[model samples]
Target: MEKEFNKKLNHLTKVNLARYSTMRLKSWGYLYELESFHEARAVIQELKKQKRPYRLIGGGSNQLLSSWEEGVYLKLPKADLHLLSVDEKKMTLSCDASTTVNAVLQLAKKYSLGGFEVLTGIPATMGGVAFMNAGTSLGEFSSLVSFIEWIDGEGNICSKEFLTSDDRAKNFSYRKNHFCGEGEVITKMILKATSRDDALEEKITKYLNYRKETQPLSSKTCGCVFKNPAKEMPAGKLIDGANLKGVHVGDLFVSTLHANFMENRGEATYEDFVALVQVVKEEVFRKFHVELELEVKI
Candidate 1:
């Protein structure tokens, strides 16, 4: 049975998880690089049969890692999936899960499909974006999502369509989307698009420039560390007001450019990152009476 499982699983032993995550922490885990939905279902079956726990990750952009104990780490592969389709009349693009948000942005640019331009600089897969409902102040991936298709725990593919005007869709509020089911692995998404216009391109350029000017985009960081407490109360401002910038626990330092970002100066450990988070959270809460919640996932 182990031999048969090995035959079906495309995997690596004792993986250096730093290579998988953008944060570059030295995390170790068993990794399965899934090739197809059939392989994914097979892996789930084998893990269930063996009673081994497992988790799925994509892009690894929003993840912080320390170690994994006795479980399978599944990737939908970093490879780009098919673009599926582009409907000019309806102004939509259907993308597969493995595709990156950057890839989607490029497609939007290619076809002059506007609204998605705000998502340009985010480094995440379509699956991760859908999972986290990732976005910036301009807009969120969830807002654009027309439908999400995923593979459930029992290996059944399911689709959930969302209407923008629906009250349930409104539940996908700031930095959160509740569309995903427990043990459900996202497979594809339909994103709303708009007609090409130079004005939209101009807006995209403006947002990109703003990010470069404000964020530590070139540094080794996991983007934002804390979610905004309110629409008017940004985490960065709170951290900065608390005078927490440049605080370091080992090599992990609060970015001087952006307080919400923690940079890995050199040889930072997971413990150091966690400690840094604790310090920031405590300081922000103590100074402002606001308890900051982590935006980055572990």
Candidate 2:
């Protein structure tokens, strides 16, 4: 069975798949560089045929495949923007999800699009943002999405859900719509954006400056370490208030730059990240009459 599995796996990486995907999750993993969507589909088909395990990865910016699970990782063939279709009349654009959010923002700016100015600090693939409904303290990611193109189970491509007003009474509670499901995938996104003007440029500048001053942009950290529990408070504030900044477990430590970010300072391990999160949760619960939740995948 194992031999059969390996026979079907394509361009497998060197690290023990188990260790790379889970125990030693890092900025690096079974590094396979693909070049197109068809190649990915072929691999997925083979895995289904061989009954082998695999997990799709994009950006590798938000994930925590635990040691307890075993699988392979698949990625979009490349990180290029497959398409960027703008509609000045609607103030929206259809974007490729494989590209980074920053790239999308730059594209938006080139076209004088305004809705994405608030996302300057987020550094992730557009697909990832949709998968997690990623957002800031002020708002959620889904609010800007007018529609999306996704691949459903069985690999059948589908388009934006057309719902009536009553059918759309509830916004996606999680704020994620485009990317979802273990076996399904998302190929692109369509965002409801605004046309830019002088005022929009000023707001963009403010967000860009905030990112420079408050985030560890120069380091190897992924992003925020934990999600804020609600509207009134933030996770970093809670952790810092508990005096947990700079706390360490192995090579990973809560970043001194921002208490909510746990960073891998060269030798950090999965164990270090997970253990430190436990510390933050405990300390915060003790200090405040509240509990904190993780923003990081692990």
Candidate 3:
């Protein structure tokens, strides 16, 4: 049965998960890189028949490979689905889920579509980006999305269209989008377009510059380690205020440039990262009376 399942997927066995994850924490698992939504749905169906547990991941930018044992890890390949389409009349761009957010933004820019310029430096696929509702202070992916197509828990492809502004904002919050189940998978999305702008180039430049200045962009780390407790009390500020910067457990240390980010200074283990996170959380709670929630998925 395992052999038969293997035949249906682009499979790799006992892969070092650290290579796939942004934080580079070593873990091993079977990886299934699905080529299309049909392949993904078929894989999900087979997993159900076998009663095998599975997880869907993208880019691995915001994920932590802590305990991925006895489970199948699913991923859409980094290659674009070549499903891009433009609707000049409606001012919209439709793309497949496997497309990177960077690619989507680049396409938007090429076509002169505005609005996604604020997401310039983010590193994630369209599906992961939409699922997390990723954004900075400028705005969120949810604000630009028109509708989504995904595989639902029942192994059926479902389309959810945002009919109103409130409907669009329904389940999204700071660093969160709650539209899909754990077993569900987002396959495609349509983004509401803004008119072409020559000034968008400058806007994207400003956003990229801001991220470069504040984030440890060149280091090996998951984007942001913790969610902001409140607008006035950002997680980094709190961790910095607690004097936790440059604190280390093994080779994993709190990034001095941004306390909310933990950098892996080579030879770091998942246990090391976890330990450091615990220390920071405990210390932040002890001193500030505020609990920090992780932005990165574990």
Candidate 4:
């Protein structure tokens, strides 16, 4: 069975990774665009059995791809974006991991679901958002997740419920979740929907407008670079207080519009990003006496 699956899985070599990650760093490596959960499971088992390093990425909106030569990268392609089911009575929606946040919002709107409006402007797949507990001041994805179906390291399909009484629910916290481990790929998720809101469209527009005004939405960035240190002190505010906005290392510059975002002006390398991050961290700590932690994955 393993041999048969291996025959079907293929990987591309020395693929340009700029298009895969929002950071747009000039990096190249092997890429496995798995078309199905079966393919993903097979790939994981093969990679593990061969002792080869691998990384899984979703929409790449929150990842900084540096040296890709160290490991092969796996991703669920657009073809995997499937709206599996929706139960209006139960206020639940189930979707494939690769389904974009926008797609989910559109479906939610069709059914008059409300809570998803908070995720408006986040350019990520459902799997990525759930894995990172992605959200804004409005709310986090953890609050909406009912359960997640994933491909574990051993090529087994596993599901974990996130009910309040479930101990696994504790794995979720600020901008992070531990349910999905290293090399485990989230395949699908069941999200708890909220009551009907006729104003869902207006709410989405409002959130979108707010993000447009405060974030560098058009810039080549990996979203927010650091997580908010506290409710009172946002990372952007801290960076601004440290006077680190507009700071640059090569073409990677701290966005003036949003201090938490680092923009790739042109031809920025991974080294430039690292240097800029170090500079910002040191200065922010010096001025605020608080250590800033990164929100984006490297």
Error of 1 at 31 (Å): 1.4
Better-scoring candidate (TM-score), 1 or 3: 3
Model 3 residue 180 lDDT score: 89
TM-score per candidate, in order?
0.92, 0.83, 0.94, 0.94
Consecutive 10-residue window with the lowest summed lDDT within model 3: 1-10
For candidate 4, write residues 203-252 as lDDT tens digits.
Answer: 88888998999999999999999989898989999999999889999999
Candidate 2 lDDT tens digits, 41-113 = 5556666776767676666666665533345566555565548667877777777778778777776776777
Candidate 1 differs from the real structure by a C-alpha RMSD in angstroms, to one decimal, of: 2.3
Number of the candidate with higher lDDT, 2 or 3: 3
- Superposed Cα deviation of residue 202, candidate 3 (Å): 1.0
Give candidate 1's TM-score: 0.92
Local distance difference test scores for all models: 0.79, 0.65, 0.83, 0.84
C-alpha lDDT of candidate 4 relative to the true structure: 0.84
TM-score, candidate 2, is 0.83
Over the stretch 169-254, how does candidate 3's per-residue lDDT look in tens digits?
78687777777877698989899865667777678878888889999998999999999999989999999999999999988999
Residue ranges of candidate 2 with Cα displaced over 4 Å: 1-11, 16-32, 65-69, 80-82, 161-171
Residue-wise lDDT of candidate 1 within 1-298, one digit each (tens)? 4466577453557778887778898778887887765577778877877788887878878887668878878876554455566787888889888888777776677677777865768988888887877888777776578877887777787788877547336647666667565446887788876456556666777888999999999888899989998989999999999999898999999999999999998889898998889999899889999999988887
